[model samples]
Target: MPESAHVTEEKTLSESNPFPDSIPERLRAQWNFLIEVDKLKTVLRQSPLAAVERRENDAEHSWHLALMVPVLAEYADEPIDIGRTIQLVVVHDLIEIYAGDTPLYDAEAGRDQEARERAAADRLFPLLPDDQATHFRELWDEFEQRRTPEARFAKAMDRLQPFLLNWMARGGTWQAPGVTADDVRRRKSVIGDASGALWEAASELIAEGERRGWMRPGQG
Candidate 1:
């Protein structure tokens, strides 16, 4: 080829493949991934903060659940790897950054929720370097599947956190129309499977909410 044509081709290739080496490229990719996931702080869930000043964002919720893993692991029905459970909780809601938070009680909001969240996960997790991306995606998937001991305990914490927060807030979301004691029990059923102690504690809170007139009564 002519020198001018060869130069043009080289420039095109350089533009298309900016980071050729894996190490530095991986570092850059990881940094970009960190920055992108920080957007999780901006995606707020329906659950209010303990203080009830505002709804908790996805980042805060994940961090809280990760913290809970160590503190509450003793209550798990089966032995759990606390570190793995923390990892599961931390990445569990990263997909929410793209999909937004869906309220548990809103049947309409749940329509196609799995597809939306899976699409979000597909787009977001691959932003990291390949190895790290794959690992994080697996952690996220493990949490979602909820079959393993770590995942079950992690999911229990996920449910318990909001349950405690709402109870403390005098029925934060429970006061919303159409939310009843039966709905609360149904949503919280998994807690019993993970930790009977936690399940009993949550039951007490539900009972208190009922007695205090925070949760609707006589539905179930």
Candidate 2:
């Protein structure tokens, strides 16, 4: 072959198969990093806090709260940045993909949960480019602090969720766990600051559940 023809062929091959480091990010399978999150829902935590029949997996819990933002927005005491709150809920439980769900009462298990979750985030985020990862990490941290209006709403949604499940299902999960009326009341109390009306509703529902024997009586 002529020299010009040979060089042209070499250039074509280089374009087709660049070194891994030189490959365009658009060609990378980066967005697929969260695929592992699907497996998280099946990894059930050993907590009687919820029962199998009404047991919500981590993914369902995350997705439910993520989509529930609009329907439950009226409960918010003030206007919320709904878009940001939605994003926070979507990403909030992704770390459960690695760390598993820690229970509300299990302080011992929660001790290193932050570290484990951060490490998981590190592994998962790098699957995306640096900028995307940084944006997500910042949002996740803000959600944790509950400092922003959106974060406050996000936390409120989180609390409201299990309350709905436990109540709607007639304390379905808690029925077997022997979750007391006192426990239910205590859990719903913190939600008051974010939305007093919703807390009132949840509180009334808890009382009914106790009356119906789905939950224990409040301590005297």
Candidate 3:
């Protein structure tokens, strides 16, 4: 090789030097985020459906709800932005990486859980570029309010999910963890305005569970 050509190649390589060890180098962020999300698998709960076995993790729940959005789209109460609704469902539970699932009955505990979730979102998503992190945080916040139609539909699915588990899992996980009638009622009430039909369907399912003795009497 020519002497001038060798110097040029060495200089180019030095200019491409990587980010420091203390920081998340761009390439490492994606895998690190996945690792954090995978930790959710350890945070399982006794299911309401198959009280016999625990429910799936936050990651599974998020994907499952996202898939259900297309089929359930027609039933939403408000005219929804289906794309936005889908996006919200996809990222909603990322906060659980920091704040574990807070069940309905734990009022005091549930209160501060949202704060922790927001912090987790910031840490996990900023691993992406600035635009991506901001957009994701906003989607998560929108779901939190349940104000818009898209958010409402997303919220309802989140609420309905547990019932499906309990209904099919033979009991929904209610008895094993001892979710009471009052708890079931309060949680189901939130689902009403989001999708009147899905809410009614959930109500019917709960009633049937009660009838068959799958659920405790007076629950829902």
Candidate 4:
């Protein structure tokens, strides 16, 4: 037989038995969910990467937030379950893979943001097997609510990551028109609720940005 014929035969066999009967159904479902969620790497957010090469994608953002949880957990106003916080951050922005990232300062985009993300969550989470789908959906909801200490701390890191990036880049997003020091301050106020120490550090960064003329001055 020709080499081309042999290649076609192998492709057909693999397609017929993509997963061997030995693999459990639940494990296959989990694998499929993992593959589907990889699309998050293509969903770009408005925040610039620390290197300033381009906008950071949802996958990188989620990973960075997850890593920040341990390093910054001590700053949380109350004790938090670090494991839960890590899980929360990892899955928190997965919905953006479908709904798309909404820029923080775009008031026009803010109106329907929650509705759009909720719909995306509904469409995406069920890709997992039943139990995992429910668990992930609940974690995403908890992070959004910001009621628990873990959620609050997770939210703080979400805001703080971009804040640090912008400041490091000499006001990457802060340079956008109409983005005053007060605007940045107002947007990041939730960090204060999580930890006064973190809030003070953010305040110092903001002041430095303003002093360097990287941030626009607020109106008198």
Locate the minimum summed-lDDT window of 10 residues in model 1: 1-10
Error of 4 at 15 (Å): 12
Ranking by lDDT: 4, 1, 2, 3
> Residue-wise lDDT of candidate 2 within 1-220, one digit each (tens)?
1111121121222234443755566445342454444465664533223445545667678788888898888779989988888999988877665556776545576687778777766666555577777888888888888887788888888877877776666655456455578876776676776788888887788878888988778784
Tell me the deviation in Å of residue 90 in model 3. Answer: 1.2
TM-scores, in order shown? 0.88, 0.77, 0.76, 0.88
**Top-lDDT candidate index:** 4
Q: What is the C-alpha lDDT of each candidate?
A: 0.81, 0.68, 0.68, 0.83
Clashes of each: 0, 1, 13, 0
How accurate locally is residue 169 in candidate 2, as Cα lDDT from 0 to 100?
66
Q: Which regions of candidate 4 fall more than 4 Å away from where they truly are?
A: 1-22
Q: Between prediction 1 and prediction 3, which has the larger TM-score?
A: 1
After the best TM-score superposition of candidate 3, give how far the Cα of residue 41 lies from its true spot, in angstroms: 4.2
Kindly report which residue pairs in candidate 2 clash with one another: 51-173
As a TM-score, model 2 comes out at: 0.77
TM-score of predicted structure 4: 0.88
RMSD of each: 9.8, 12.4, 12.1, 8.4
Candidate 4: residue pairs that collide = none
Segments in model 3 whose C-alpha atoms lie over 4 Å from true places: 1-35, 48-54, 176-178
Give candidate 2's error at residue 122 in angstroms: 3.4
